[model samples]
Target: MLNRVKRFADKTPFSLTTPNPQEYTLFNQAILYGVLIEPYFTKIHIKHLHAIIIDGYKLFLSLLVGIVNELYGKLVNSGKEQLIWVTKEMIDVSATRIDSLLVCLMRQIVGGDFSNGNLWLCFELVSLCLSKWDCLLQEKPVVLTSALYTFLRLLADHCRVSNNLKPMMLRQMEIEFFVKMLRDQFQLCLKIGRDLFHVPF
Candidate 1:
């Protein structure tokens, strides 16, 4: 299974900064972020679970987050890194795809079905994205604003529920930070205009 996973990872054609157009797709990204991570859940040792798997899983999660961070940066950043020109369609699909994947991963990680380690990974992933909000604002406002809407929606949904799931669900301070960032981004959009995010902020 590990060999198969490694092969899959090696053959994964979904690169954000690649020059090849054929490799770009949400389906490929889903395979990377979703399917690639699934095997670990079942393959973990039953007895020496934490000793064998926890750290590796955490690292894998971190890698996923970092890939996404870079993906966003590559999309919105100037064309210095690309050998070929990026298209509008590429930008549109790449940004929206990441947003959707992150939301889906968030749901999977936070649900009771996953282990506590995976659950906490949700916070790490969210923080990774939110930490880049300023950069996203400058480089890819549309993507950033779309992300803000998704996050606000998630926050609203979380609030409506009674289950806090201590240590897994976000703390009040974290919630405040995210809210503040969203509000500030919304205000920035107002000054910048609807053209920034493609929607009225």
Candidate 2:
């Protein structure tokens, strides 16, 4: 699939002119898959995608949302890493529906799972939220609220089950995330309502 997409990309010159809609979608799908499956060549695949992207990355992001929603757990470790990297890239570009993509990733961080991958995801996401705090608040405050609720809930589970250093580190990160949200966006935290009170400290 990557080879075929590269062949098409090589033949096609970069232009703002839209290609056939169906073909364009197919190419995006192929490239998205290639990005996830070929981590070593991610930059190359991303450059090819940028050359052909004509939809503000909406189609590519939507395809990514679907993958994160349906296949995140099944993805290999490197694939998961690439997925998060591409997500950060999309955030950098301020892609459309990026909030939804973020929410999808938040959902993928399963609570009470002390596995390394789960802990890593929790850390990565919390760090992403912290790093992009201003952009997220300005662009989609609701995603911050969602993260607040998610981490608050996860903290409860972590407190109950965690005894190791990794989980401890993740718990600390989650604490920082919600605390920042509450300190800077108290009113937004209020939107969480009764659930906020119910989360075990």
Candidate 3:
């Protein structure tokens, strides 16, 4: 079935199905989270929440990988390749957004935002940071800086929620040991002269 669909799409000219890229991306992301991820986001189970966070972080990292591919100029150029790239990118971002949506879900489940829920908050924070992976890769200082600011606030909120969350999360958050990763991105922004304000990408 997938092969049949791919073959049909392959035969159609890009012009026939073309849409505004940004709008396409937005719609795709929304559908992924709203339809697919929402099913597994039940907060009654911390395991589900944990899974959401892990999936979100993975999605964010996927963006970083995509940016890397884009940087190396590996952007898909046609048919099957382009279709694969688009699908992968949308899935990555959708996974991340669903992770973020869980934030509001957690709030609903917990009866309020738990400031000390560092694990959830920080996971979201890192997602935001990596969300700017394009800006970072394209050397867009201003956008990266803005991402950093948002990341800081998310981290701070997590800190306010619960101390135990961090400690418990820490043992598992080993991959995120570089807690201040955003600071590195910030320095890069300053070094580049934050002059344009517009993301270069």
TM for every model, in the order presented, reads 0.36, 0.89, 0.31
The TM-score leader among the candidates is 2
lDDT of 2 by residue, 26-72 (tens): 67877787788778778887887888888889999999999998899
Count steric clashes of candidate 2.
Answer: 0
Expressed as tens digits, the lDDT of each residue in 83-199 for candidate 3 is 223333433344443322322222221222444443443444344435545543453334444434343333343444444655335323322422344344446545434442422
TM-score of decoy 1: 0.36
Q: Model 1's lDDT to the true fold?
A: 0.40
Instruction: State each model's C-alpha RMSD to the native.
Output: 14.4, 2.3, 15.4
Model 1 per-residue lDDT tens digits across residues 145-173: 44444444445445555665743265442
* Steric overlap count per candidate: 0, 0, 7
Worst 10 residues of 1 by lDDT: 80-89
Q: Worst ten-residue run, lDDT, model 3? A: 41-50
Mark the regions of model 2 whose C-alpha exceeds 4 Å error after superposition. Answer: 1-17
